[model samples]
Target chain A: MEPLLSCENVSFSYENTAVIKNLSFHVNSGDYLCIVGENGSGKSTLTKGLLGLKAPAEGKIIRGSDLHGNEIGYLPQQNPAQKDFPASVFEVVLSGRLNSRRFRPFYSKEDKKIARENLKKLGIEDLIKRSYRDLSGGQQQRVLLARALCAGSKLLFLDEPVTGLDPIVTEEMYKLILELNRKEKITIIMVSHDIKASVLYATHILHLNFDKSFFGRTEDYIKSPMGKYFFSE
Target chain B: MFNFAEMFQYSFMLRALIGGILISLCAALLGVSLVLKRYSMIGDGLSHVGFGALAIGSAANFSPLEFSIPIVILSAFFLLRISENSKIKGDAAIALISTSALAIGITAASLSGVNTDIDNYLFGSILSLSRSDLVICIIVFIVVMILFILFYNKIFAVTFDESFAKANGTRVGIYNMLIALLTALTIVIGMKLMGTLLISSLIIFPAIISMRICRRFKTVIIMSSIVSVVGFFAGLVISYNRSTPAGASVVLVNLAMLIVFYVIGTVSDKIKAKKFLKQ
Candidate 1:
C-alpha cells in the first residue's frame, strides 16, 4: 500500500532561519509513529508541516490522495488563551466538523451525530452540556480529543498529548491512545518528549538528537547506537 | 420632564431609536470574537481613525460616512496586518494608531475650523441622526447582519483556533479581513450615536457582560445581543427623560449591568466551589 504521507528532505524554518534540516520519513496507514526530541527540536513543527499549517522551506511533502490536511485531526498543545473560552463541550466538538460542511451557515445533524459519537467514545458524553472551561484538565483533554476525532477520518496527530498531566492521567492517556491504535486501527503520529513511553507504545520511532536523527521500526531502533545510548542513560 | 411615548412623535427621535438599536446589535455581535481574541480595543482604534477621516471629509466637503467608512476600513485592515506582522501586537498597536489618528483629527479640525462639528461627532447628539443617516444605517446593518449569520460557523472556528481552522482549509486571512471590515463599518455607523471615544464601549460592554453570566458561546452571543438592545433602549429613555447625554447614559447602563452580573458570577462560583469541596 502507498504510504499515507512521505517527506523528501524536508526543512522547516522561521524567519529564514532553519530549525529542522533535511528530514525525511514516511507514515504508513495503521502505523503508530512517535516522534521524540528535546525542547525546540522541531518535533511540533514537523507535525505542523505535515498538516500544511506551515510550508517547508525546502524539499517536498507528498500526501496520499485521500489524506489531505483537512482530513487529518490534530490536537495542539494547551495554551492560556483557550482556557477561558466560553464554549460548551458540545459546541467545541461541533466546531471540529466545520471543515466537513463548507459554506453552510450552521452545523448539520450528521455533524452533531459525529460529535456525539466521539464524546461517547471518549466517555465524556454526560459532560456535553457543561462549559469547556469548567472541566478538569483530563476532562478538557478528552473533549479536545473528541474534537480532533470529529475533524479527521483515519489519521490523528497529537502534539505532546500527555504534557502537564499527572503521572496517572499520563498513563491513562497513553493507554487510551494505545487502544485507538490497536483496536480502532487508526493511523497515529504522535510527538512526545517522554522517550521511554514513546518507545514502549510506538510501532516506529523518529528520534531527533539535534546532531543526528534516527528513524526506524521499533525493533530495529532498540538495537541502534542512539537507542542503546538512550537506554544506557 | 419628557414622556417616553411622546418622544417617538419627533422624526429625529424615531431615527435615533432605530439607528441606535441596529448599530448596537451589530457592535454586540462582532464584540464576542474581538473580546475573545483580546482585540477588543480595535474598535476604539478604528473609531479614532473614523474621527480623523471625518475631519478630513469635512475639510474636503465630502459626506463624513462616505469618507470615513473607507478610511476606517483601510485602517482596520492595516491594524489586523500590523498586529499579526509586527512585534507591537494587538493592544499596543491599537494605542499607537488611535493616538496618532486622534492627533491628526484634532489638528485637521482646528485647521478647517470644524472643531465644533468635531465636538458634535465626539459627544454624539442623538437628534443629529439625519434621514439619510438612518437609511445608510439600515442598509449597512442588514448587510452586516446577513453576512455575520451566513459565516457564523466559520467565524466561530476562526475565533476558537485560527491555526487549526487554517489547517482545516478555512482561509484565516480572508476571514480576519472580513471581521475587520465589518467592525469598521459598524464603528462608523455607531459614531453618529456613540461618538469616537465612547463608541468602543458599545462593542465591548455587551460581550464581557454576557460572559459573566453565560457559559456557552451561543448563549453568550444571544445574551449579548439582548443586553445591547435593551441597554440602548433604556439609555435612550433615561437620557430623554432626564435630559442627559445619550452615549454616556447607554455606557453607564451597560456598566451597571456588568457589575451586577460580575457579582452574580462570583457568588455562583463560590457555591460551586463549596459543593465540589464537600464532594
Candidate 2:
C-alpha cells in the first residue's frame, strides 16, 4: 500500500529566506513519527507545510487517496487567548466536528456520540460540563487531545504536547499518546524537543538538521552518527 | 413625575422603542463573537465610516441608508484585509480608518451646506426615527438574526481558534468577512438610534457584562441578548421621561449593568472558592 503521506524535495521560505530546504520523507499508516529538532530548525514551518497551512515553495506533498484534507487532527501550542476563554468542555470538543458538519448549522447525533466517546477515551468525561479555563494544565491538555481525536481518528499532529506540564503529568501524557499509537493504531506526527522520549516511544524518527537530515527506523536512528551525538548529549 | 402609561402615547416614541430594541438585540448577538475575537471595536470603526458615507450620500442627493450600506460594507472588508496583511495592526488600523472617515464626514457636512443637523448624527435623536427607517431596521434585524443562527457554530469555532478552524477546512476568511458584513449593517442602522460614538457600546457592553456571570459560550450569548434588550428598553423609557438623548441614556444603562454584573460575578466566585475548600 502507498504511504499515508509523502513529501518530495519540499522547501519553505519566509521573506526570501529559506527555512526548510529540500526535505523529503514519507509516513506509513499506523506509524508514530517523531520529528526531533533544535530551536529554529523549521520544525514548525515543516508542520505548517504538511498541514497545508502554507504552500511549499518547491516540490510537492501528496496525501493518500483515502485521506481527506480535513481528517487530520491538529493540537496546536496553547495561546494566551485560550487561557481565559469561557467555554464548556463539551462546546470546545464539539467544535472539532465543524469540518464534518460542513454547511450544517449543528452537530448530528453521531458527531455528539463521537465527542462523548473521545472525552471518555481521554478520561475526561467528568469534565464535559466544566469550564475549560478553570482546568489545570494537565486536564486542559487532555481536553484538547480529546478534541483532536474528534476531528480525526486516522492521523494526529501534536506540537509539543507535554510542554509546560509537570514531570508526572508529562509521563502520563506520553503514556496516553503511546497507547493511541500502539493500541488504537493511530498515525502520529509529533514535533518535540525531547529526544530521549521521542526515541523511547517513536517507531520512526526524522531528525531535522540544517546541513543534513536523517530518517529511518528507531534502531537504525540509534546507531546513526547524528543520532549518536544527539543521544549522547 | 414619570407616567408609565403616558410615555407610549407618542407615535415617534413607539417607533424609537421598536427600532432601538431590534438594533440592540442584533448588536448583542454579534457582540459575543466580536468581543471573544478581540474585534469588539470593529463596530465603532465601521459606524464612523457609515457616518462618513451618510454625509457623502446626503451631499450627492442619494438616499443615505441605501448609499451608506454598501460604502460601509466595503470599508469593513478593507479594514479586515489591511489588518490581516499589513503592518498597521488591528487597533491602529481601526483608529486610522475611523478618524479619517470622521474628518471626511465633518468636512463634507460643512461644505455641502445642506441644512443637515450634524449633532443629530453625532449624539442621535430618538425622536427623529421615521416609519420608513423603522421598516428598514426590521428587515436588517431579520437578516442579521437569521445569518447568525445559521452560522453560530462556525463563528464560535473561528473566534475560539482561527488556526484550528482553518486547519479543519472551516474557511476562516469567509466567516471573518461575514462577521464584518453583519456588523457593518448593524452599525449603520444602529447609528441612527445610538449615534456613532455610542452605537459600539450596544455591540460591546452587553457581551462583556454577560460574560461576567456566564461560563459557557451559549449562555454568554443568551445572557447578552437578554441584557441588551432589557437595557435598551429601560434606557428608552428613561430618555422619554427625562427628555434626555437616547444614545447617552442607553450607554449609561449598559454601564450601570456592567458594574452590577461585576459585583455578582466576584461574589459568586468567592462563594465557589469557599465551597471548594470545604470539599
Best by lDDT: 2
TM-score of each prediction: 0.96, 0.95
lDDT of the structure predicted as candidate 1 = 0.88
Task: List the RMSD of every prediction in angstroms.
Answer: 1.8, 1.9
Per-residue alpha-carbon lDDT of candidate 1 for residues B197-274, written as tens digits (9 for 90 to 100): 899999999999999989999999999999999999999998888899999999999999999999999999999999
> Which CAPRI tier for candidate 1?
medium
lDDT tens per residue, model 2, B1-279: 678678788888889999999999999999998888778777889989998888878877889889999999998898888767746688888898899999998899989895445677778889778899999899989998998899999989998988888889888999999989988988988988888888899999999999899989999999999999999999998887788889999999999999999999999999999999999
Kindly give the stretch of ten consecutive residues in candidate 1 chain B with the minimal lDDT sum: B82-91
Q: Scored by CA lDDT, what does every candidate get?
A: 0.88, 0.89
Which ranges of candidate 2 are over 4 A from the true structure? B114-116
Error of 2 at A80 (Å): 1.3
